[model samples]
Target chain A: AQKVTQAQTEISVVEKEDVTLDCVYETRDTTYYLFWYKQPPSGELVFLIRRNSFDEQNEISGRYSWNFQKSTSSFNFTITASQVVDSAVYFCALSGEVVFGAGTILRVKS
Target chain B: DARVTQTPRHKVTEMGQEVTMRCQPILGHNTVFWYRQTMMQGLELLAYFRNRAPLDDSGMPKDRFSAEMPDATLATLKIQPSEPRDSAVYFCASGSGTDQGGYTFGSGTRLTVV
Candidate 1:
């Protein structure tokens, strides 16, 4: 069975504060993919990043960055300077059956 | 950018009433996925189609829920007798193939069974 766990159910941070969301996954397949998605109040899911198992390179996009460590089986997402606009629910997913985490509700207060 | 489109952005139905949600996947995309989101379950995959053929629907409730892709452009999820527990946001996503890392999701249908 494939499973993704987002331990943090909710996190609140003030504006300009940095926050990191932790994601851990379990899968038997040697080759699989991991993904992150953001769902704002609008109820639409926005794709953030996708990382394959073979490529363990960390990725950074502006104020957002991801650290993928196969050794720990963890893919963490960090927001450098969180803003009110960044408040949303973030989901971590694993491929194969596309199992999704319980999602972390982030509240960035200005 | 082409995107998935879903109809009836919101629906309110009485318990035991039948409800149908529709989805139009992105053009040229061969894969369509249906997902349900609730506070308790978060996001759950109800079913999916590949090349307009049903691939996996094991996640769906066989007695009440049915998903089908009548054609390439359209996909439908029907609940014969929706219950209050079935209230959730139904999302439709589309991708090119199995290897497609990310899928384009629709705005989703907010279904409320009262």
Candidate 2:
């Protein structure tokens, strides 16, 4: 069985501030995938990033950055200089045959 | 760019009514997934198919929900007698393979049961 835990249910930050959303997952499979998705108010899920278990290298894309630590079983996402448009529910998912996650709500206020 | 498409973006029904949602995966994609989203349960995978064959549906309630891919391009999710608790936004996603970055999602079908 695989499980994903997003500890923070909700977070609020002022615009232009940096925020980090925490995610931890448990899986016995040697090969699996981790993903981050954003659901805005419009209710559309936008894919943010995807990392396989083998790749421990951290990734940065524009204003977004992800740290994948295998030792801690954590994949954390950070948004730098966030804007009001960044307000959305973020989900961390673990996938093989089936994917699962609860998600974290982030509010970026001006 | 190719994209997944869903029909009946919004649906409202009473208890005991039948509801069906449809999805069209991106052309050439071989896998499709159905998911339910709610405030309490962020996202739950109901069923998925590969090569138009049912792969796994362990997350679905067998008594009321049925998922099938009749052909290559279309996938359908049906609820025979829906309850208020079944109300949530249903999402359909597709991927090229089992790879990490293969998936792409549709906007979703918002189903409200009363």
Q: What is the TM-score of chain A alone in each candidate?
A: 0.98, 0.97
What is the per-residue lDDT of model 1 for residues B1-114, given as tens digits with 9 covering 90 to 100? 888999989999999999999999998899899999988888999998899998899999999999999999999999989999999999999987867769889999999999
The lDDT leader among the candidates is: 1
Docking tier of model 2: it is medium
Interface RMSD of 1: 0.9
lDDT of 2 by residue, B43-96 (tens): 888999989998999889999999999998899999999999999999999987
DockQ of 1: 0.83
- Residues A1-110 of candidate 2: C-alpha lDDT, one tens digit per residue: 88999999999999999999999999999988999989899988888898988999999999999999999999999999999999999988887754656788899889
Model 1: colliding residue pairs? none
Error of 1 at A66 (Å): 0.6
The true-versus-predicted C-alpha distance at residue A71 of model 2, in Å, is 0.4
What overall lDDT, based on C-alpha atoms, would model 2 receive against the true structure? 0.90
Specify the poorest-scoring 10-residue window by lDDT in model 2 chain A. Answer: A94-103
Model 2: pairs clashing at backbone N, Cα or C within 3 Å: none
| Chain B vs. true chain B: TM-score per candidate | 0.97, 0.96
Displacement of residue B5 (Cα, Å) in model 1 is 0.5
Encode model 1's per-residue lDDT on A1-97: one tens digit a residue: 9999999999999999999999999999999999999999988999999999999999999999999999999999999999999999999999865
